[model samples]
Target: MLSRRLALAVATGAVAALALGTAAQAAPARHGGHGATLRTLAERPDLLIGTAVDASALAADAPYRAGVSSEFSSVTAENAMKWEVVEPARGSYDWSQADRLVEFAHRHHQEVRGHTLVWHNQLPAWLTSGVADGSIDAAGLRAVLRKHITDEVRHFKGEIYQWDVVNEVFDEDGTYRDSLWLRELGPSYISDAFRWAHEADPKAKLFLNDYNVEGVNAKSTAYYELAKKLRAQGVPVQGLGIQGHLDIQYGFPGDVGDNLARFDALGMQTAFTEIDVRMTLPADEAKLARQAQDYRRLLDACVAVRGCTSFTVWGFSDKYSWVPDTFSGQGAANITDENFVRKPAYTALADGLRAAARRAGRH
Candidate 1:
């Protein structure tokens, strides 16, 4: 069997090259007189550019669908793969929306990254209630969690490339979040989740994904220690996903490359799983330009890391972004405008990808 790193590299190069080549061929009809298409800029063999997409948008919005299909080599479901959507009730599962997104990805010749398997948020009432009341004890909750991970992983065994097995489990101060899982199942919940997910689908890369861990700080240090400990204990954790949700207000993370390098040294692949550089309302030329710079820097950081195989935007277009809804006065986080027109940030990303491809070519 090929080593994990070799297997990942080969898969990434083959998929990205094929996707870029196909997209480049279709650029004229799709993008018309637009400068360089995202695919054209991402004609690199070793890296995959991706975006999260809503299932409804994929089905109903032609422009959204076309932009996603042509610009990205990988697709992540924004909400379909969440626990609430997958298992809304105890033992009752729904796969319709998730399956739609997966099928859409397959049709576009793009790999699918499962958004998440275990998270503190987006939990169904049934599961949370079981945890709240005495209905589901510690052991019962553990069993339910295992089943959820196993069933979900098994269902999408060969379809998904990676899964955020345990998401945002740590707090900002380097401590475990007092989530339902932590409260009931204890800290071993994270390791158990990874193991269960691996048992269900040994081939899929299991990742610990989180926000605010893009830079070397307390939270990321927590991840570094936990990842080291897990690997030392022979856990199946294979990747670290830094959710690069940047805001112009807070400025960009300065040590993103170093942060990725530290995780890469732990024998784990790193990915910018959910990237979006948002700005305050009423975007101006200067703000857009700064966003472009931020986007470029982020791509630069990812490409500079050998183990960073994927860079995924949270969503491709501002029309479907979660920024405005989640954070008041913060919007326009995507590379595309509401009309599916490429923004300056999009150009910066394309240019960064092209430069990274050239750098990779030299090596």
Candidate 2:
């Protein structure tokens, strides 16, 4: 059976808490262009708003798509580094999709974040069942895993500003997930992944990404201990990726500001990564209002925490979200409906940002 940590990782690939900023300023709306959100938001140095772009978005010749996403300064691809895309046939490699995404970032003059170098979900069938059947022992798994991380990082060196070196390795029970990494090489595989990534590209900031860490729980507690220990061991881990895939059914964090501050106090940067608050099937006004409030609370926490750097929604619009179909009875997560109109959550986030700016000025 898979460990709780591994189960959660498969369930939610998630969090980063970083409030990197210079000064607060209102972002100017773009009239028209073809670029990701960060390309537009990079206009002002104070705020960092971002979103994950699908490969299809880049393919489509949408009108002024850049305008809708202009208030962001950083870009993270949703699935560019998954195992299937990076190592489709175990040894054979394909860099076409990732290469195009990087080129798009360069063309628009935006900083790119490598979604991940290590994950359990998107691994190739060879490794998944191979490890299951004992065809690949611990030593064999370690060799393959390390090589994959090192090569991916080296290939995208200098282009990606930050790399999610080790992603979704913890379970909600605060234990290391029982993944191929755990089953084969044991828990040390995670530290090795981070170390290898650092060796591949020292300039790239390494992050441990996971979901459901927004509030204090067994999972986040384990992350806190891991991060603290890694820092003590002089590991290259730099940031935490908080996959904020919230649900209105469950109450939002009551002390979000304090949670962020606690992480910031630990000397780690925080980022609102993969943020999307969902509602039960057949969304209603009450749920939408709750979702808006949840979004506001998250943004307010980011603004209040000095070290919070980036805030990225999983996707810009609900039309492209992976949630509705992935999770039955769960819909209405993105800032826009399927039709592309701004939802209450979007307005609430912008409003919270403005409030944060005003409060920052007062300070």
Best-performing candidate as measured by TM-score: 1
Leading candidate by lDDT: 1
Q: Rate the local accuracy (lDDT) of all candidates.
A: 0.84, 0.71
Indicate the TM-score of model 2: 0.85
lDDT of 2 by residue, 165-209 (tens): 788898879878877677667788778888999999888777888
For candidate 1, what is the TM-score? 0.91
Q: Which residue window of length 10 is worst by lDDT in model 2?
A: 15-24
Candidate 1 C-alpha lDDT tens digits along 182-260: 8887899999999999999898889999999989999999999999999999999999998899988886886888999
What overall lDDT, based on C-alpha atoms, would model 2 receive against the true structure?
A: 0.71
Ten consecutive residues with minimal summed lDDT in candidate 1? 26-35
lDDT of 2 at 161: 69
